[model samples]
Target: MTETIHPTTESANRYLRDNFAPVREELTATDLTVTGRLPDHLDGRYLRIGPNPLDDPGDQHHWFLGEGMVHGVRIRDGHAEWYRNRWVRSAAVADSLGEPHRGTPGERDFAANTNVLEHHGRTLALVEAGAPPYELTHDLDTVGPCDFGGTLPSIPGRPGYAAHPHRDPGTGELHALSYNWTAGNRVAYSVLGNDGRIRRSVDVEVHGSPMMHDFALTERHVVILDLPVTFDIATATEDVPRLVRPLVRGLLNRVIGRNPLPEPVIARIARGGDAVSLPYRWNPDYPARIGIMPRDGDSASVRWFEIAPCYVFHTLNAYDDGDTVVVDVIRHPTMFATVLNGPNEGPAVLTRFTLDLRTGQARETGIDQRSQEFPRHDERLTGRRHRYGWAVGFEDGAPGDTLLRHDLDTGSTESRRLGAGLEASEFCFVPNPDGTAEDDGVLMGYVHDRAEGRSQLRVLDAATLDDVATVHLPGRVPAGFHGNWAPEGADLADV
Candidate 1:
C-alpha cells in the first residue's frame, strides 16, 4: 500500500536560499582539496547541471524554472586537477551576462537546466518539453544549441531534445522520447546511431500531453508512459489575473473536481488565473496508460495497458524476463501539488512494475517503501536483467538524505549517510576498469553541507556502501538534477 507522507516543506522560495541558491561567481580553483585517497582508474570530469537563475525570480520562481549552470570537477591521474563553473548561455542568459549567443534560428531558446551529457564528441546541456540541447565545450563553456548537425527534426521552429535519453550499451545507440506541448497528443521516438545522427524516428500517439521525464527501454520494446498529469489550457493563457485565483479555483473545482481541463474543453468553458502557470497537474480524471511498443513497430503496433494514476520522474532500468517486461522506476503519488514553486508532491518511493505481455495485465510492487528518488542501475546492463540499483533516500525526521543500494536478486538493501546536516543527490555508479563482479565499482555524487555552507564529491564503494573518497569542493553545489561519471577518452563513445 502507498503511504501518505506530507514532508515538512521549507519556505516557498527555499530554492533561492542556502545551497539551492545560484552561485554568483564563476571561479576556477586548481589542485582542489581531497579528504581521502582518490582512485587511480578514474580520469575525467564529474559533470552536473541544474537551474541557476541569473537573477532571482523571487516569489514567482519555480524550482524547475531558471537558467542552467554546469559544474565540473576534473580528475586526472587520481588527482583533483581543477574545478570550474559556467553558465549555459541561452539567449536570455547570454543577454543578461552580456555574452554572445551562438545558436542561430533557435526555435525555443530556453534554459537547458535539467541534465548535461556528451554525445558524438560534443557536450550538451539538455532540458525537456520542447527545447534543443545547448552544446558545451571541453572546459564547460556553452557552444550554443545543437540539432544533431541540423539532422534533428523540428517540431516547428526548433528540434526538440529530451533530458534523459537512454544509450544502448550493446549497440551504442541513443534512444529518446521527446514531447512538445503543441504536438497534439503525440510523442516522438528518436534514435541516434553511432554517429549521433537520427537513425530512426517514430511518432507514438498518447492520450494526453503527459509529463514524461523518463522512459524504459527493453531488449524487445520501448516502454512509454501516458500518465494523468497533462497540460492545461488555463496555464497557456496569461490574461488571467492573480486577484481572481480564489474565484477561478472555486469554479474549476465545482465543475471538474480539481482535474485540469484540456485546451479544447477549457476554451469553451473557463479561463485560468496566475498561480505560477504550472501547466501540468495531478489529473485524476484522465486514465493512466503505458504503451509497450515493439522496437521495430509503429504507433499502431503499440499495446496500451491501463495502470494506476501516478507520476514517475526517473526510471532505474528495464529488461525482458521470459514473457514479461520488468521496469523499475521512482514512483510519486502526485506532482505540482501543494505548491507550484517546486515538486512538493507526496513521498516518492521506488517501485517495480511487471507487465505481462501474454495476458495484458500490469502489476506493481514496492521495493523500498521509504521515500527515495533518482534510481540508477548499471548502464552496462541497460537493456538486460540487472542485480543491483542505487537511489537517494529521504527518510522522515532525518536532516540529510541517504544513499541506498538495492540488490534485487537477494532482496537486501544497504545505505550510506553523509552526516547529520549533509544532503545527497543522485549517485552515479562507475564500474571498475578491471572487475569480475557487477558491483565492483564506486558510486559518486554531490553532497551539500547545510551547516558548513559547502559541498563535496563523495565516492563510495558500490559493493559495501562505504566511503571510499571525498573531494572537498571550493563552494556549494546545490542539490540538483542528474549527472554522470565521464572518464577521459571514453566520452566520445561513452553512452
Candidate 2:
C-alpha cells in the first residue's frame, strides 16, 4: 500500500515542500517489488545524488545549498536485490546525526551533493566550488574525502575540481575544466589518468570565476564554456525572493518601530540570509565566449571564440568535424535574473553549436524550443559524434510528464508522455551487451508517483522510448542531478 507523504517542515519556499523536500531518515529495503520482467543482462547498480537538506533554512533557503543524499538500487541475476538511500555524510551531517566523522578532515563544512560516480576503483560523491569529493563504500557509507591518492593537488585549502568530468570512452581517462571561487581569474584544465590520479593540471587564464558546471570534449580538443553567469557579491547579500520579501520587510520595520531605521538599513536587514552558501548569479557585464584548448597542448595554445549571452548547466556531447567543433547543449535564455532562491530563468531550450577552429566563430542553431533540461546520450558516444540524445522535460519550470529522444542526424524528436501525476527524473542509457547500434540498450532513472507518494526505478527501451520494466523503490527519492550505471564486474569494494 502507498500513501501521499508531505514534508512537515514549515516553510513558504516551494523547494522545501512537496517532492523537492528532504526525507528524514536513511532507509534500506530488500527483495523489491517489480512490475515487469527484470532484464537478466542488466547486472549492475543505478545511483543518483542531489540536495536533500536535513533541516529547513526557512525563507532564506536556496535550492542548491542543501546536503546530499544518494539513492541506489542493486540488480543481479535478474532479481532486484535492494534499494538504499544514504546521506553523503560531511562533517556537519555526521555531527548532526551523532556519528563520528569519517575521512580526511575537510577545509570547510560543505555538501557533496551534485553527482555520484565510480572512478578507477573508488566510488565518489562530488560537488563543485572549493569542496573536495567524499569517498563512499560499496554499501554507500562515507569513506572520507579523496584527493586521488593525494595526486589531485590543490592550492592551500582550495580543491579546484568540477562536479562534471568527461571521460574518454577510448582511453579510460577523465578530462575536466575545474574552478574555485577564490582562484580568481584562472581555471585548471585537469586530466585524470587511468589510475585515477591527476596526470596533467594546467591553470588556464579566464576573466573571472565562472560557474563551469560542465564542458565539451572532442578527440583533440577540450571545449570550455566561459559564459555570462558568474560569481556576484550582491547576489548573496541582497537577492531574496519576491514572494517572501514583504514578510521580511514587515518584520524589519516592526523591529525598529520606536527609532525608525533608515531605508537602506531596513532593506539590507530584510534581504540578508544567515550565510553565503552559493554566490553565483547571472552577470550581463561578463562577456560570453568559448575557449578551445588542445587536449595535447597547454594554456598557451588556447583560442577563444565569442558568442551571444546565455548560460548552460549541461551539454549533450561534442565532436570534431573537419576544422569545426560540433556540440549539443541545453541553453537558458538567462539565469537567476529575477530571483535568488531558485532557478527562475528557465524552461531551458535544446540547441546545437558549430565552432569554426580557423575563423574563431560560432554558429548557434535551435533543435528543440520546448522547455527541457538534463540532456544525456549513450556514454559510448562521449567526446565523439552521435545520433541520439535524451532529456527530462519541464513545463513552465515544473516537472513535465514527458521524456524525449532526439535524432540529431534527421532533426526528428520522439516523446513519451507519462500518466497523470507521475514525474520522471534524468534517465541514463545502459548499453546492451550484444547491441550493435547506439540506441540498442535500456534507459534507466527514477519516476515519482504523486498519488502514491513513492518513487520507482524505471527502465525504457532507448530506441522506441517505451516502458520495459519498473523496480519500485522503498521510498520517495527526491528529484536529483546526475548518475550513471556502474556495470557489475569485479566487486567495487575489492577494487
Candidate 3:
C-alpha cells in the first residue's frame, strides 16, 4: 500500500501565521547607506580579436569599466564588504606571484567564471577562467595570484578561456570543463588530480557559440545550458538626410532597446543554422538544461532536457541516493518584454524532478506556486541521505511577494508572503554538526527592500521557518545570483 502524509492542523496554522513573516520583519527594511566604491585601478580590460569586426573588433582593447563591479555581498559581524576579484599574474614560482601586476591581472578573469561560490566543508571551490585560463582561489579575504599553467586555450569571438570546474562526490575528482569559444564552441573536460595537476584534455562537441550560460554535474552526469544570441537591428534601416539622422537615431535606439533583434534577422538566422545556430526560441530537444551521469571510471553519458520555452536560468542540487536530482528553473522572458514593458509581468516557476539514474528516465515530482518566479534551491544539509530536505522559491503574487518552502518527502509546501515593495533571492540552509535530530536544518537568505533601498541576510530555523537572526548590511548588495554557506573554520572562509 502507498503511504500518505497530510498537512497537520498545527503545521498549517503555524505556516499561516509565519508564511509572511520572512518578508514583513525588520529584515525587509530598505534604508541603506552607500559605502566607498571599489578601487578603479583593479579593473580588468579586454580586447576584441577575431574575423568579424563587430563580433571581434580586432586588436583594439576595450575596458569593461569597473564602475558596475558591485553585484553580491557576504557579511560577518557588523562589518560588511562587497565581493570583487583581484587580478594576479600567472607565475611558476610562489614568491613571484604576489601582488600589483600589469595588463589586467589574471585573477580578475578567473573571478568571472562563476556567478557564485559553493563550499564543501571549509574547502571552497570556484570555477574560474576568462579571456585567459586561470583558477582564482576561493579563499575569502587574502588575495593570491591566479594560475593558468602555460599557454591557455582561447575561445574565438569571445575574449576568454572556457573552463568551469566542479567536484564529483562519487569519484572525489575535481573536473574542469573547457570550451573553445572562438572555434565553433567545442568543449573539453580535464580532471584535476589531488596534487593540483591537470590531466589529459579530451575535446567534445556540444554546439558552437558563446551563448552557453550554466552547467552542473552529478555522480553520473554533466549538464550544459546555452543562451540565445543577441542581434542589433537598428543598424539595418533606410538612409536619412543629415538633418533627420538624429531623429532617426533616437527612434532606432528606442525600438532596438525594446526588441533587440529585428524580425527578419531572427528569421534568417533561425533558417540558416541548425538547432544550436540561433540564440532565440526554446528548442524542445536541445534543452536549455543538459545533465550528464557518470558511469564507471572516467567515462560519463549526457542527457538534455527542456524546462520551458523561454530562457531558463538554473541552479542544480544533487542527492547521493541516486534516485533524485532537483533543478531550480527560472524563466527569463523575451528581450522585447523586458526592455519595453519592464519586470512587472513575466512569470516564474520552480520545478523538481526525480531522475532514475539506472533507467535514464526523468520524472517531474513537484512544483511550487506558479504565479511566483525566480526559485533559488539549496540543500547544504542533505549530506549522505537525501530523504529529508528543504527547498525555497519566491512568488511575486497580487497580494505581495512570498517565499515558498517544499518538503521533499511529504510533498507539502508552505509560503511566507511579503508586503509591497520587497523582494528576496538566494536561499541557503546551514546544518547542525552534532547529528542530533532536533529540527531538519537552519534557513538563511537575503531579503531586498526596494522601497528603502537595502538588503539583509536573514537566518531562520529550517523546521519552523521562523526568523532567528538578521544581519543588516551597510549598503545595498545590488542584487546577486547564487551563494553557498561554509561552516565555521572551513578553508573557504580563511581567504
Candidate 4:
C-alpha cells in the first residue's frame, strides 16, 4: 500500500500539547511508584510458578495464585458455596526478579498477568511479570522456542499479551495469537500440542498501536489488524519536564486519537518481519477495532472487517456458524475525551456482522444500535450447535438503565430496569448441567451500590430473567472489569 502524509494542523498540535501533556506526566509518576521488590507477606490461598523462575525474563512460564480460595458455584438446588482447593500451598514465590504485586489490587509494579483457557481443555496463564515467579510443577513443561517455529521474538521487559485460545478445525491445532508491544508492533502466534506444548511461534508485524486485541482464528490461519502509529512509553512517564512533555504528549494523543494504519499495512505486517513507513495522518481520536475471521484451507484467505470513524477499545466476542461469523462489537464512543474529562455521556453499541467464510464478504445485519456496555456471553451458553444466547448488561436511558436480554435471532431486545438507586455491571449465565432442557439455567451479575460502597452478586433465572438469589461479597469486589463463571464441577482453582 502507498503511504500518505496528511498535513498536521496548528490547532490540533496546540490541542495536543495543552491537553495531553499532563496525562503523560502522571503516567511517569505512576511508573516511578513501582518498587522493584515483592512484599514480605502475601496473604493468598495458593501460589504456583513456572518451571524455571530464574530463566531469562523473556521465556514463557505459568503461575497460580489464590488457588485454595478458588471454588466453582453450582446453580442446582439453589445451594451456592465455595469448594476449597484439594491441594494447598502456604506461600510460594516465583523466580521473578522484581517485587511481586497482585494485579487484583491494581499495583503498577509489574505488568498484568492474563490467563487464557485453551479450547483443548488446557489452561495457560501468561503472567506479564517483569521477572519470572517461582517454578512450579515440573510436569508442566516449558514450550521451547523451536516449538514456536521462530515466529515470535522475545523482547526484554515487555511481553506480548494473549487472548482466549481458538481452535482450528482443519489443522486440529490450537492457535494462540498475541501482540508484542515491546517489539515494534508485531503479532505472533503459537501452535499448541494436544499435550499442551508450544509447537510453533511466528512473528507477524501489525502496524498502528502496539497493543492488539484478540485475533480471529480458524483451522488454517490467524487474522490480525495492523494499526498504524507508534506507542512511546517514555512519553507516558510523568517525570518528563513540563516544556518538552507537551511535544511528547501531543505525539501520544495524536497517535491514539487517529489510528491511521491502512489495509496494506495489515497485510504487510502479517507477512512477517518487514519495516514499513508509518502513515502520516491526524492524531487518532478513537481506538481502532478490527475484526478477523480465519478461512478454512487458504492461509491468506482470512476476512477483515473495520469500524471506521468510530474506534473500539473494548472486547470483541464472536459466534460462528458453518458458513458465517457473527461478531459483537462493543465500543467506548467517548474514550478519547473521557481520558481527560473522566466518564462522559457517550453511547455504546452491539453490532452484529455476518461474514461469508468462503467469499470474505462482510454484510452488516442492520443490528447496529445503542446497547449496554461490555456485553459478554456465558461460556456454558456457547457451543457448536447452539447459536442463540442471552447478553446481560445495563442499558442506556434516562432516570436509570435496565438489564437487557438481547435476542440474537429476532434482533428484538427486552430490558428490566434496576429502579433508580441500583446499577449493574456485566452478567454471566450458568447453565444447570443436571436440570431439564426446558430450564434455561441461572443468570448472575453484580449490582453496584456506589453510595453504600457495596456490590452484590445477583442471580436470576435465565429463562424467566427473574431474580433467583443474591450473594453478597465481603469488602466489595471493587467494580471489576470482566469476569467468568466457573460451574459446580469445574475447577475454579484452575483459573
TM-score, cand. 3: 0.56
Residue-level lDDT tens digits of model 2 in 1-495 = 655665444667777877788888799999999888878898778989989997666766778888999999999877889899999888888888999888765554466898898878778888887577888987888988888879875443233678998888877677888876555566778888867788988877777667888898999899889987776644434445667666654653343212223445434633454653467878898899888888877778888888899989999999999999998999998887777767658669899989998888899999998889889998878888999999988976757679999999999998999779888888999888799999999999998887788898999999998888899876898877888887767342222
List candidate 3 stretches off by more than 4 Å: 1-145, 148-180, 183-185, 190-202, 207-210, 225-310, 319-345, 353-366, 371-401, 418-420, 436-439, 491-495
Worst lDDT 10-window in candidate 3: 45-54
Ranking by TM-score: 2, 1, 4, 3
- The digit string of per-residue lDDT tens for model 3 on 1-495 reads 312212123322121112211111111222322233222221211100001001111121111111111123333333333332232222211223453433334322322323333322212223322334323333332233223343243322222333235555444445555542232434555654444445545544453232343445555445445444222223222233456556655654454322233344323322332121112223233333345534223323455443333454443344435455554344454322332211233555555555555666656544554544434333322112333334444444212345666664565667665457656655655554443653455655566665555555665666677666565553344333345553334433221
lDDT of 1 by residue, 1-495 (tens): 322212213535776765567777786889988877788999888899888878857666777777888888999777899888888888878888887777663646777889887667778788988778888898998778888867776544122678899988877688998876656567888898878688888988777667788898988999998887776545544455667545654554443322333444343222333234556767788888788999899999998888888888888999999989999988888876565666757788888899999999999998888788778888988979999999888654122568889999987888877678788887899998799788999998898877677778888899998888899877778767888877667744545
Give one clash count per candidate, in the order shown: 0, 1, 26, 33
Instruction: Score candidate 1 by TM-score against the native.
Output: 0.89
Question: Model 1, stretches more than 4 Å misplaced?
Answer: 1-11, 157-159, 239-276, 395-399, 491-494
- In the range 159-259, model 4's lDDT, one tens digit per residue, is 33353344443344555566433334445566665544456656553444344434444323344543332343342324445565566445545543234
- Model 3, position 92, has a per-residue lDDT of 17
Q: Scored by Cα lDDT, where does model 1 land? A: 0.77
Per-model CA lDDT versus the true structure: 0.77, 0.80, 0.38, 0.38
Most TM-score-accurate candidate: 2
Candidate 2 regions with alpha-carbon error over 4 angstroms: 2-4, 8-10, 154-159, 235-273, 490-495
Q: Give me the runs in candidate 4 sitting further than 4 Å from their true place.
A: 1-78, 82-154, 157-159, 163-175, 191-196, 216-234, 237-307, 313-316, 319-324, 337-345, 356-361, 366-368, 378-386, 392-401, 435-439, 488-495
Q: Tell me how far the alpha carbon of residue 363 in candidate 4 is from the true structure, in angstroms, after superposition.
A: 2.9
